[model samples]
Target: MHAWESIQASVDYIEEHLNEDLQIETLANVASLSPFYFQRLFNRLVNKTVFDYIKMRKLSKTSEILKSGNSRIVDIAMEYGFSSHSNFTRAFKETFGLTPEQYRTEPVVLNHFVKPDLILNYVMVNENVPLVTDGMVLEIFRRRLEQPRVFAGIEGEIPIEQLMGGETTGVAAGAKLWENFHKIKPRIPNLLPDGNELGALYLGNAKEGNCIYMAGAEIIPGTTAPGYQTFEMPACEYLVCGFEAENISQLYGDAVFKADKFMNRWLKQHQIRTAAFGVEMYYPPSQDAAYLEHWSIPEVDS
Candidate 1:
């Protein structure tokens, strides 16, 4: 197997055996590498030590379980191989800045560490032939818009660090903005019910390292909504990268992050110039539907 596949295999093994004792020797064996080499490769690829990755993944899983059901904290901790409740509490606080009990009492959106799908970084296939691996399907294609598309929604500025960090303390700024947009969407007129939601992220301040994020649905031209911001995408050909996940929950962190990375790499490899902003188009979940489409407008040479 290739290096990426080997690492991915070890990662999959870690996920399956998260509730059990995961030993370095065993994981290395899964990757068919020596423990020392495995450790180095894992750290280089994942940016985390093996031990840290496992601990963080366990804590992240514990957080999900804490929110989903009424289970004792100690039980959850023990299940994930924590030696005791105090140890678990200490680690949870250090990682998430909250005790398990506190998080369960008033659950705020915690940016849980998602399992990495490294294959997205390596695969680049034609649009006509999508790449499928481990329940993920990725497609890249070019699309043209005959006319400008307008969106009506609310806009918010998000820190570039938080947006790219892949983890957040509470409800993500973009998510909160989307919630607000949905709440006011009913009042917006001339919205196409069948249209997909669009989230556009543009550079807001280079020195400040912030980006402006807008969330809304497409609206008919000339449609006006009070107290709403309108964004327009000019008629142009776009390089679209899309992916589908078997588990809808993966759509948020794991899938979107990987897809964005893939799209950026693909553009760079092709020497493609794109507009300043990036667009994320969200579609309703269905067997036939792609949960998200990452759109980039190729710059037209003047």
Candidate 2:
């Protein structure tokens, strides 16, 4: 089976047996991979280690049970494998930003634990028309990048919660920075012609909520543009995912989010090494649709 197919099988198994103890060795065997390789691959693709994913899922289910107002908190916690009521409360608060009592009172919607669907290794895009996956034209490529590109734009270190929600102040800050960059675009020297409005992502730890993203463009060598910060990227092989959308403005951020998720899974399944960084490329509009690209570093073999 393909890497994605195998990995997906493991995911299905986990979902089916959420309450049971899941061993890494068992999951790795399901994926037909070694314990070490499978563990690393699962972490990279899912953005959470296997244990974390299982724990989060348990908490997520518990939250729902809490909303029902039926089961006692202690019993619910024990059912989900938490040893004590205090342990469950601590984890629940950390994951959902609310204590069990607070959550039970308000029952606010937490971030959805989206089950990833299979991301096709290849996709086709046609200009002007809405994208249809008929295997028409595949616009993907793998390029070896030997040098890093310098970027100048707005930078924001946002809490992951705010970043993912799109309605948070963190996202607003990024929007403001992008807007400021545009106002001074003409004055920025050495800007690349037809440059991609890249949203470069720097994620340190999957479990941590802190993430840094840059909204910027490639600049010429040794060029200094005032009022903008510079980020120097290291060179590596890249997998370029291409698509054409009707509204490029709305697509830019959405594309980056989806691409990052897909790439995280893709990179591990293929045993491709990549830095935790990704670039979002926004190109000029075409007659048919706005063209966009997501660039991901494919780790070089040692």
Candidate 3:
């Protein structure tokens, strides 16, 4: 059978026996292979191990039943193949950080828990920058932005001890940043050139002015630029700068000199690292998105 056929067969077997004593050996046998070979093939074809796929699928289905608030936790657990109520509860808590009961009580949350966009919430925080934590607001930005060139290194999903922060620096010390911009591809791209990005996630309210913007905010967020080489950009009007600054890094008051020149306030929230390489257009806002313009900062997606 083809790989897809094998995968479908294995998945069927798993869904039917979730509560039973499950293991790699059992599924490998079901897939008609040795455990080592089975595990490797599963990972290569499914982008997940057999163990993870089964667990996630079960938990997702259980979450749906729980949201209905009609079934008892034990019943829901059993239906999904958990060995015991305690075991089911433990797994649910670990996966969601909240108990089944607690999650179901929130009507909207329970309804949306299984939804991909709803479930995969991104947590962004820029701890190094000095700013107040209380008044920050994280907003969802959906807009198209003009793509620009930038310089920076890239980081990969690996151990830092292995190399220079894992993979190549998307932006090297002096490597023209835009050269490697495509390396850090956008998490998602917009459809039309004028289409908005998946979202322009806000870290928080703009502080006095320490906003850091990079150009590669969305890696090709707009409609394909075709020959021009499209780059990601959220199509939306930014709450342009109401804060002013000279140097981009020093937007925050780190040194005594910067402190003296610092704007009155800077919204010190977490930075969304997923946006494209963007430039911060700083200025004190007179009304809405308009501003006097201080310094430009490039941005990227979180």
Root-mean-square deviation of every model: 2.2, 10.6, 20.3
lDDT of 3: 0.41
Error of 3 at 248 (Å): 42
Best by lDDT: 1
TM-score of 3: 0.37
lDDT of 2 by residue, 4-31 (tens): 6777788878878877888999999999
Per-residue alpha-carbon lDDT of candidate 1 for residues 172-232, written as tens digits (9 for 90 to 100) = 6676777788899998878976987899999865347788999989887767666788888
lDDT of 3 by residue, 127-153 (tens): 223332112222222333354422222
User: What are the TM-scores, per candidate, against the unseen true structure?
Assistant: 0.91, 0.49, 0.37
The 10-residue segment of model 1 with minimum total lDDT is 163-172
Ranked by TM-score, the better of candidates 1 and 2 is 1
